[model samples]
Target: MLTFYHAPNSRSTSIRQLILELGVADKVKTVEVTIPRQDGSGARDPKNPHPEGKVPYLTDGEDYVRERAAIILYLTDRFPEAGLGRPVGDAQRGRYLSWLIWYQGVLEPVTILNWAKLDHPAVKASLRDYDTALQRLDEVLGRQPYLLGDDFSAVDLLCAGPFAWFGDQMPATPAIRDWVARCMDRPAVRETAER
Candidate 1:
């Protein structure tokens, strides 16, 4: 049995969608770990899984996974039927992995930095480059329905979220909007979003 330490309104909903996507929704025992409660109501203890006290953590009956990208990739690997990882050595596989990592390396911080209203010269200086990142994403999305091209994969879920889930999320993101809608339409996504 796998225990997924998750919370509502937090990043864990994405993980929940993944469980549904994998078709192993029942195999995954979801533990709703609400945050900021301080009543010990969630996966708040870093020592339990993420060491950083994150919302989404998974224990595959043995090991604990904290990061969203890591969890997505791992689930796809463990359950090949999920089709989220795609085939090995495939060019799209590389692209899939790239987008998955992009969330952490680019999307996460970039979205937060822009949303938080940081005005420090140093902070403000490089922040402008987020447009370039957004541009790159837009260019890629313009070419395909999914980030990896025609196929929907785990990486897609990792990119669209709390930060970029609005009208102004991207200045002109029609393609990105379409892709997000495609992903959200997945039965798994709908189920998880409702949670």
Candidate 2:
């Protein structure tokens, strides 16, 4: 059985939702643990196996996966029957990977900087600003219902998770906001929140 170390109200909430979406809740064992929050509210849990003591850490036998994108990839691939992931040969595979990486590499950092109200030219030149990132998402979501064309996949869940938690801070455009609403309206997401 896979062991999932999760913290309530953390990024792990998305993973829990994904597990429910995949109908694999019974296959994995979830361990609720506390993690250090940005506001300095909680302490690092000794039970969490993540080197940095982060939530959403997964241990399956000798293999372990950390980071939201990596764990999303791992779980989706592990349960491909759920059709939440684009397999290697699928045409959308490249796009799928790109969005996941972008969420972690670009969007997340931009959000942090935006929340901090730090405006640096270098950051704008490199990762760009929050508005720019939102523009990219807006463009894509405008064309289709999800990040990857019409299908609602893990990428959508991964991208929309932040907005569900921080809509007030993110200030998404109409298209992005609508897309997030569609994603969050899913029963799995609602169930995850209720948990």
Candidate 3:
């Protein structure tokens, strides 16, 4: 059986929600682990396998997956029947991969930098600041309801993480706000948030 290492209210919530979305909750077991804070405040379980002591780690047999976007991709690909993943031959596969990668490589870092108030010119040059990032997202979302169009995919699931979790940190754009609300309305998402 697959075992998911989870921490309540963390990025792991999205993965747990994905499992529920796939209706494979019975196929996996969830194990809660404590990840020590960056300031070394919380308890860090020695039994936890996450290298950096983070939540949202997955152990499938001997295979371990970490990082939010990677974990979402792993789950979606593993359960392709859920139709949350755009597989290799799909025309939207490249776009799907781009959204997933962008969330981690671009959005996340930019969000962190913006929240930390580190608006250096060099940082803006590389990550383009949070407003630009949000506007870029809004441009795409304003065109379509989901990242991949009408149907919601894991891309939407994972991409909405920051907005849904951080809330007011995201810009007040209608496109983004509506998209986030739509994504949050998912039964699985509501259930996950309640936890």
Candidate 4:
């Protein structure tokens, strides 16, 4: 059994959506606990399972799973019946992994820099949009349908979740917004968000 330490109205919601989409709703049990980040709550302490003291940590009746991308990959791999990923060694799988990794790599840094209101002119000057990494991401998203291309996978959830979660931070993210809208309309997403 899997025990997901969850907090409503937080990033953990995406994991719920994942579990539900994978048709493993009954296999996993959620430990509901509100995480008041502004006030520092008990459930959100990183010491629990999540590395960053954030919601969405999972204990798979054995080992602890932290970070959204880790959790997604863990669940998807743990239950391959979900078909959330492409066939192994497929060229498309590389794209999937790349985008999934980018969620934590490029997305996190770009979002944090924007949220922090900071800039690095030295490197940014050489590239477009002041050479910011987010601008480079925007260029990629402008071309791809789902980050990995035409089909959707666990990586799409990984990328789309953060892209949607960080709304208004990059208000010009039309493609991201449209993708999020499509994801939100999915029955699994609606069910978890409502929960």
Q: Each candidate's lDDT (Cα)?
A: 0.74, 0.91, 0.85, 0.70
Each model's Cα RMSD: 3.4, 1.0, 1.6, 3.5
Backbone clash pairs in model 2 (N, Cα, C under 3 Å; residues 3+ apart or in different chains), count: 0
Which of 2 and 4 is the better model by TM-score? 2
Per-residue lDDT of model 2, residues 1-195, tens digit only: 999999989999989999999999999999999999989999998888899988889999999999999999999989999999998899989999999999999998999899999999999999999999988998898889998888799999999988889877778888988899899889998887788
Whichever of 2 and 3 has more TM-score, that candidate is 2
Q: Lowest summed-lDDT stretch of 10 residues in model 2? A: 161-170
lDDT by residue for model 1 (1-195), tens: 888888776778888888888899878888775465545555455444556667788997677787888888888887887688866766577777778887876677666776665545675354444666678778988998877778888888778664335546555578877777777778886777676
lDDT of 2: 0.91
**Which prediction has more favorable lDDT, 1 or 3?**
3
Pairwise lDDT winner, candidates 3 and 4 = 3
- Candidate 3 whole-model C-alpha lDDT, 0 to 1: 0.85
List of clashing residue pairs for candidate 3: none
**Ten residues in a row with the worst lDDT in model 3?**
35-44
Per TM-score, the best of the predicted structures is 2
Q: In model 1, what are the clashing residue pairs, if there are any? A: 33-42
lDDT value, residue 29 of candidate 4: 85
